[model samples]
Target: MTYCLALKMNEGMVFASDSRTNAGVDQISSFKKMRTYNNGTDRVIVTLTSGNLSITQSVVNLIEQRANDPDVPNVWNAKSLFDVATLFGECLREVRKETAAYLDQTKVDMGVNFIVGGQVAGEPQRLFLIYSEGNFIEATEETPFFQIGETKYGKPVLDRFMQPETTLVNAIKCALVSLDSTVRSNISVGLPIDLVSVKPNQFEFNSQYHITEDDAYFSHISTSWREGLTTLFDGLPAPDGFESNTQAAVTESAQPLGTPVAQTSTQHSQTLTPASVNASVAPVQPSSTQTEAESSSQDNQSSAPTTSLMHAAQNNQPAQRSPAVAANQQNTK
Candidate 1:
């Protein structure tokens, strides 16, 4: 498992990924997931990869090996970011084809994913998510971010805060928080995190950071975000009718067995209280006319109303009577 995310904003593009990968619990390792290709003058491309490590590594190695070849189009020589994404998808498919010879498709997961983004000389900055089938989709205004690999834990933060108009610095903060949220919840996505930022048409990275466990700013983000959420939750108002619910519970518990409970504002019907909410019965001193079994049956009848009353009070509805209990009450009436 892994976590990688990219944000495309009006100011530029931001990319981030965790370093941890594992074959199993016993075989944990760290590897760089972000790769860069740039010729300072003409173009710049950044890729964050996830899935089978060997497949991603092979695809990246292939791109680098063929980048300088004069006869073919490559990431370095591609005219636009779209062309670069296409070339990357092609290379990824080629790598999978090579591995498919011996590996069983059903038994082994050969799927891979990439977040490819940056600018070429004539085009604006663009971001894409390249899939295992050599297909890709670009980020747009409504969906200004993309995430791959263990995406659920970190996605709420990004969905709430990410926007096309967000500034570069704020986007970086959002990305780091998103990663931190994931790292705390998932063991597979650990740090040190690699981050890169690029401005539109700059054709080179504007900022790069590698955040480790002890990095002061990253530590502050983790602590502050946790504390802030705690404070916010503590300060939130309680739901309506909470006080009534609490009072009803207290009243229900205080009543003696066979005591008739008064209808509260929240309860829609009358009820008989039992000795305890758990429906337990204290040992009964059998009457002269009653046997031990008869006393036990009477205890069960008395406790049967406890469940229906508690549920009705919570839902502010009428208590539903069981058929046997209803018939017994009718006979008494």
Candidate 2:
């Protein structure tokens, strides 16, 4: 198993992945999970993989082979990010076809996931998560990031902080914090992380850093974030109606052989109205341009029929008018 994360932000894009693969406790190994293909400043494609190491490696090999082959359509010749994604999906499928039989014979599952992020010339930076089946989904404003293996432990931090308009620096910080949380929770993920950042329309990545165990900045962030979390947890209010009892039970649970009492809510419940629920949920504001367009449409809808009627009456001849109006018009004429 591995962990790969990629973020698409307004400022740029950030990509990070770990480099640990293991078949068993005794067969642990390390391999670079991040790969980049740059085509003479015209485009740059970065790929991170997680899951069955053999399958992923095979997929990578296929991509590289086709990319360099001149005779075949590959990342270099792909016209758009969507084209690149399609190429990747095709490669993944080919690898599966070639290796599935052998892997089945060996009783190993052919599970692989890829997070691909980059830009082609004249296109905005995009991110995609490609599955083993060769299909993918793009990241968008509503969902501005993607993660591959061991994602659950790190997802909460991302859900709390990531946004399409987040700064690149802040996004990187969040990614690191997320990776730290995952590393602490799972042994399959480890240090020597690969990080890359690309500015929109730049055609090349702006920053690439390899964070090892001895990296000073990473160490500082990891420690500070952990301390901050502990402090924040400590500062939260205990549940009402059981504050003292809950604290006592928590303390007892920490003891070696104590039977701690389970804390249960004793407070009266209040029925929630739609307005209350709406107030609790965050409000999403529409763009100013959309609001303006809506207002203009309303104005046009209100005035269009009246203007049409007046123009029609002015253009009409005397006999074209209705009988009641024609009689009054003849008397005026």
Candidate 3:
């Protein structure tokens, strides 16, 4: 599992990814998922990858190997960021095709995804998401971010907050928070994040960070965001019908014993409360007008009704008194 994302904002671009990779529960490891290809003068391209490590690595290696080859077009010499994405997409497809025959026999996933972005000397900064099938899409103002691998856990914050006009500083912060959210919710994603920022038309990385567990700023962000959410949640008003339900319970408890109460469909379906359980099993007493023998007979009747009531509660049926009590009442009538 992995989490890699890129934000294409008006201020610039932000790229980030978790380093943790796991083949199995016992086989966890860390590898940098963010890669940079730059000549430091003409072009600076950043690639963030997720999926089968072998496939992603092979795609990257193939790009780097052919980078200096005079016969072929490569990332460095590509005229635009779109061309660069096409090149990456081609490499990804080639790698998967080469290994699918061997890996498919064992049902191994050869799926690989990439977030390719940066600036060529003459072009503005841009971002692209290249799919496993070698097709690609460029990020636009309407949807200015792309995420691959374990994206769901971290996507809410991004969907709610990220924008093309967002500042670079805030964008980086949002990216870190997004990664933190993913890392916390998912066991497969972990610390030591690789982050890079590029300013428009700079043709070079404006800032880069290697954030680890001990990094103070990231620690603060994670802790403060968590605690702030808790505080915000605590301060929120109760949902609709919640207070009414609570008040109903309070009112129900204050009612006199043996008083009839209207039960909602929900209450009827719910498990018995402690008070209800106690009432079901409590001893039944004879009235003052009953004769001594009748009183003694009612005392014996009490035990049978208590047992019957318990079964009635379990089966969600109305409790019934013992047949003996009904017979005695009938005789008195």
Candidate 4:
């Protein structure tokens, strides 16, 4: 598994990818997931890759070999970013065709996902996400970013922070924050990250960084993010009575995100104090009888009131029988 992300902003584009590769816990290794091909004067292309490294490496080598040959269409001579994206897809298809059958026999997959972006002279900068099948979708204004490989852990920060109008350095910071989120949560993604930035029409990289565990800035990002989350959690107002009772509160129970915070609340969720519960219970409900028996006697009563009583009961409170309920029970008796 890997984590690679690209942000296409109005200022330009920002990209980040981790370097860890592994077949298993013992087979861990480091390899670059980013490839840059540029002439500096007329064209620039950067690609971040995930999935089978062999397939991607082969595809990249093929593109480079063809670019230098001059006898074939390449990034250097491509008419636009669209044309270059087509070339990238074609290269992936070629590599897949060559390796697919043999790998299939071994039940091994040949999937390789790519995020390719850059500019060609006289054309606007563009970004694309190329799948293992060589087809892709371009980044649009609505979603000016693309991510590939072990993407979920880092996506929340990007969804929260990134936008086309975001500044280049700010986008870079968000990318690092996203990477930190993934690197800490998943063992398959380790670091020594590669990051690149480009400004529109620049035709070359504007900033390139290789961040390792020891790098001060990256270390700060990782430390600060964890600390910030800790602080945020500590500062939140917990549900009433959650902190006071140690064993029987939320910490001791199995709960999901959708459940209400205060389990023992009724009366429209606001009146949940133990004293209120007792006061509400003692006055209206009589002992040694089912509330349902009394409710049945008041069949002519409107369902709206009975529904309200049941709703409160389901909220872990005593069901309050109204005056009509007591009169109904008397008539039934």
By TM-score, rank the candidates, best first. 3, 1, 4, 2
lDDT of 1 at 158: 91
Tens-digit lDDT string for candidate 4 (1-333):
899999999999998899999999999999999998887898889999999989989998998899887778998889888988899999999999998889999989687899989998898889999999999999998999999999999999999988889999899999999999999899999989999999988877999999988899999988898899988887776554355333324432233323243433543544445323322332223445677677776685655444466787778766666767778899998
Q: Which pairs clash in the backbone of model 1?
A: none
Q: Which has the greatest TM-score?
A: 3
Which prediction has more favorable TM-score, 3 or 4? 3
Per-residue lDDT of candidate 3, residues 200-250 (tens digit): 767678899999889999999999999999988777765432353234333
Name the better of 2 and 3 by lDDT: 3
Q: Which sections of candidate 4 miss by over 4 Å?
A: 240-333
Worst 10 residues of 1 by lDDT: 274-283
Model 4 lowest lDDT segment of ten: 275-284
lDDT of candidate 4 vs native?
A: 0.85
TM-score of 2: 0.72
Give me the displacement of residue 327 in model 3, in angstroms.
28
Candidate 2 residue pairs in backbone clash: none
TM-score of 3: 0.76
What is the C-alpha lDDT profile of model 2 across 94-117, one tens digit per residue?
889987888899888888898888
